[model samples]
Target chain A: MTLLESRSRTSRSSHGGTAEDSRPGDLCLVVMETPNAPHSEAQAAVSDPPADLSHRLSVLLESIGRGDQAAFAEFYQLTSRRVFGMARRVLIDPELSEDTTQEVFLQVWQNASKFDPKAGSPLSWLMTISHRRAVDRVRSSQSSTDREAKYGASTQDIDHDSVADQVGSRLEAEAVVRCLETLTETQQESVRLAYYGGLTYREVAERLNAAVPTIKSRIRDGLIRLKTCLGVS
Target chain B: MTETNSGRNGRSGSFGDTVAVDLASGRAVDLAELYALDALTDEERQAIEQYMSAAPAAERTEFFDRVRQARETLARTFRIEEQPPADLFDRIVAQLPVQGSGPDAGTPAPPASGHIAGGQFAPRQPASGQPAGAQPAGGDELAQARQRREERRRPGGTRRWLAGVAAAAAIALGGVGVGSYVADQNDPMNQVVRAGDLREASVDVAGGGTATLLISSSEDAAVVKMNGVPAPPAGKVYQMWLIPKDGSAPVSQGLMDEEALSKPAVVEGISSAAALGITVEPAGGSQSPTLPTVAAAPLGA
Candidate 1:
């Protein structure tokens, strides 16, 4: 893939359909004779999200603790890109990522109080939220591929060193990577396949032809080593 | 058995080893790993989440330091790799109304006490009105709200959440109805089983050990597609039929599309088709296949 810094301040309108035009209102279009749908279409109308965004989201999320909206919109702007990126990375569909971003934002709006700054930074918390949702989407969207295959891509394609790079262009990033370098080859390999690639510990086991316990141990040891490398006690 | 950990009263189970305070110092394992990868099991993840929730303030900053490192590294990958669609944020920010835009969304003028309790900003009142929010409800409010909900509904009533979902679904569907056709809208199961969520129904075809049916549609015809190795070949093609679970006469849904015989499709009349089956028939498709071989997966969410 070409290297393009994702510095989008705002480009959702370019997706073509304007907010007024994007009402998911018409179910007759998205669903057809599919059975067991609620006998009526009335049950299909999800609440429409409002259309306006120009504030910093961190501010909005802060207000959300007090049940604020402007704060939410601002939070949306600041975080939507990261949220969408995280979802798309996992789900592999821009449209799905967009939808997932919306869902996560709505969730953030509703659960703002749950955000505890003392726990982690707002961005980190948001990343966790998006990550969890994306994982769910990939799991729920399984088609002909068996669950095992569905989960396989998440593992084999992880780009580890870059995660450190994304956080900031600081020495801390280098330090984390440096620590990663300290692990035994097997331990490091296991960690890369699992985290960045999104593979389950079991799939890693099958791919490596090693027993599950060994894989688990390698993961635990790899993480411990990583923790030490990052200078965590 | 996995060890059962009943965390202080009714809290969810946690996964990581509990760190004794002195041992919990930040120099060992990095905190960023908790959110960095998809490798952790659901249980392990939930554990990390719970721990994060309860983690002390000092520990959290150390964790974010690791997350920032991960972000720095993650940033290097891309053609908008993890970039948001341009201006998506600006558009979202623009739509927010001016009032109620602050930390409290500019706090809606608190309503009368009764309505206040129900107000979106009403202080969450636990039990007999222990004010859920001190400014906004505090942790006590959350606990009290849960406690009150438990008292009113029952402890950990998974049903309340489901009921709330059902009620919300009804109100939403009611608003969209052609007139107030709120027939089965009250039915919880109806609320849960959406057409999009419908799972396919299936039965075995002759020598074919297993066949999965992919059911889809147009306003006109219900398309039924089957995928299976198939049983011993009869002289003719296998015909498809709809056997309604309600025990109605078998409706001739239609012949399977030849392309669909290998893949999935746009079928008609499927919502009404209760159970699906396949039978050996003349290439044109029999009014009813000789025998419904395998019943296909159920359709309708």
Candidate 2:
């Protein structure tokens, strides 16, 4: 089983508070809470107000820039899963994704001073770094063969259902799913394939059998629509 | 929109042909969405960057603001949080420079001190007369070329490598002379370092310092450079082995003493090696890697 599956299972069992010691109502409570409980402390933090979370991350980054290990650790705890999940989504190989995630955090620690809060939100900065690193790993020569095999094995549409299954519990993620539903089929596919598949616009166009300009405009239009729906400006 | 396009066209015509058309058609502004989505290739991104660089400061700020918002919105869609493996943080910690020993510790060093030329280890030359963090002649150009090449090979890899080297140099060199000691073209280490597909990884030694392994897949060789690493125990020496990916026997690369450790050790025939492992061995070396390696840097093949 995946580490996430094992973790959720452990969390479920722990929430049970000893099966033999629990009453039926307690069991029912555990059952009801299972789907709602944040998977970890980090996930719990995700429910914080977006502005507060972003501010906290920016503060942590400034501390980390001064070589604060504790701040670095806290930052890692708050952001690692998102970083790793993005890497895993793009790279598909857990080992490589893990390596990329490690590299991303190391970069965070070393170059936290480069984080310009004026340019973007802390989460956006972090995810930008994460996404670029993951895409680079996928495009690197070392993984080319693996990528070829992956491409051969799976040319189908992105499994949004599976993506939703993984992220469905989070409020922001649910809103994102709702917003994604507002996109046209082509726009959604183009954006998803380019962003998550780590495919370039040209590659996305090729994958969908569309023109490059069409794919580019679709991705751009789709993101614009998402920006509107998500109220990000 | 037409007025905006005509004004942009007057300025963008001098930038370049593709960029001129992109701006004239008002697609350059729309390309911000593609840029934010990372759907554009390097060339396309550069085109957009050129267009933005030519625009008025206020316009440029507005464009980037839009891009940032778009990226932020898209980033929120990736909410599937899977906990990274428990040991990953520890691994990152191990690579971090010790507190107060990093480049930011009250030193006004060049920001570029983080970058080390490929295969060019910081040669410990106290008498070389180059001050710590001094930029060599044409260093900026070389660094930019290296950065571009690195981005072409693997985006974001150069930054991470720079970070590693910065941390490693800070700890291993004690924050002194972190500038690249560029060797002449005739140097064998230079040849491998200059390879198009050069890659590197560094690991902390058991006692102190760091050992960096620079791998060139195109050259089928790797150069192992040791900095501030203590010599092996009396009657013992450090030996290198190529640990095969197939789970076969470790192949001996060579041995290094105090003097040899100061220089780069070029290990050829690393195409099949999963990692370069170093172990403490009797002076001449051992047939196989001794249990518990002193240091090992994965080739990431």
Candidate 3:
């Protein structure tokens, strides 16, 4: 898969159909029937998101918390691509990811008021929901025995380096890549196996032919290094 | 042999031994990182969540932030795979329970008092009253507000949250409609099923089973619970309709939840609904009830 950095700084008038053009009730008729049709005919009805995206997203979410349908639509437009992208990676199936994406947005609409800025960034909050839903879809559709059988065979010849190299080149920030590069190769491998491959540590250990305890420490220690390097605080 | 082998190289002896140490540490900082990376086993993940339930809000938020930060940084490594299908956004908005339409319609303002008794874990009352997973409600305005503030903080299925909200609604509205008499407080459907104001009737379905129609004392709401209702054939669903006494077209309340097949669903906003009707419609449900009504329970009967 090709890697493309997300550097959207301004809201472009790309997606069409303005909020004023259609009331929610009339638009809902189209939605309930077609279900898969594009809901927003226009771009999200907001000025360009300021350089500080977290504040803008939080502002939009606050409006959504008050039952503002237009703002909810806008929030979906801003975040749905990344949300869908995460679901796609986790599930590795377009159809399942689509359904999962739909479920995540629905939850967001119903529970937007529940978002606490103090907890984390809006993207993280949103992606957390997306990842959970995607993982759920993945687990529910495939049995554990099937997953283990598949992973055991496929992961043996998997070239994880190629995956990371492709991802690293397109990352928006060189600093993130630089921080990741600081880890020892084994540390990098273990972290990549768990994070991108969506494998548990036990599964990761099995793939790497390492002890579980060794894998655990490698992952934890590597993360600490990355956190310090990235200045996460 | 399996236990001994795994224990020989496992992180802290056996899995059980590891859990003891993990919990004794008093925080799941390591586990949260693993969780964000999708690295924890199912058992380890659940244990961490339970541990998180007991942690302080600041700690929980910090843990969540760390996890999210890791995820965001890691995410920069990949690209968008594909756009979601069209009109998906509209369907999402349409499904949200219409805001400002219920009893709390005019009360969109924040609560007046800022008091809620804070607690480490927000209680979740499961459907069955067995108290198997039910936690005590963190009573007080501050706790309640905090609970509302972070409703999406944890990841219990939203269906459970919906049931809890429905029960809370039943409790709050129960006092307003019936001043003197009280509905059974245990039933989540009590708001629409007070004893004094109840108008009940039952009809036997052609295929078998029974549909019970219950109107609240104020006649503004209803609850329809079905028992042993045969599942609709493939590609079809069992739908419920609220037929008005004023000659309006039957209104659909969407498909009935399978779990609620036995548990009654509170059907609100039914001021002049004359009768309840059940039908078999296409999978997503029809705009109106179709064909011979499988069963009908007249409100006046």
True contacts kept of each: 0.16, 0.37, 0.25
Cα lDDT tens digits, model 1, A1-233, are 00011111111111111111111111122222234434333122111001111112334566676655434533453455457656655665556666677768767866777776555446656776676677667656743144345336544533222223221122334555576677778877766555434566666777777766466556655565565554333
Cα lDDT tens digits, model 3, A1-233, are 00001212112111111111111111222222343433331111111111235666787678778765445655665566567656755665656777888899888877889998876667767877777777667777875455555444544623212212222122323555687788888888888666545677777788888877667667766776787676555
Task: Name the lDDT value of residue B22 in candidate 3.
Answer: 55
lDDT of each model, Cα atoms only? 0.42, 0.60, 0.52
- Give the C-alpha miss distance for residue A103 in model 3, angstroms: 1.1
Tens digit per residue, CA lDDT, model 1, B1-301: 1113222223333323422221244222232443455555576556555666677876666555655544323322111223343223333333333332334332332222211112243321223343321111233342234334433643322222221211111111111121122325342222322223222222233443334333333332232333233432444665566777577777664554343354323344666765566666666777755753534444432
State how far residue A58 of model 3 sits from its true place (Å): 1.1
Best by DockQ: 2
**Model 2 — TM-score against the truth?**
0.50
Model 2 root mean square deviation, Cα atoms: 18.5
Better of 2 and 3 by TM-score: 2
Error of 2 at B241 (Å): 40
Model 2 per-residue lDDT tens digits across residues A148-228: 457444445233222233222345557777888988888887787777777777777677777665666676667878888
Q: Cα lDDT for residue B108, model 3? A: 19
Candidate 2: residue pairs that collide: none
* DockQ of candidate 3 against the true complex: 0.13
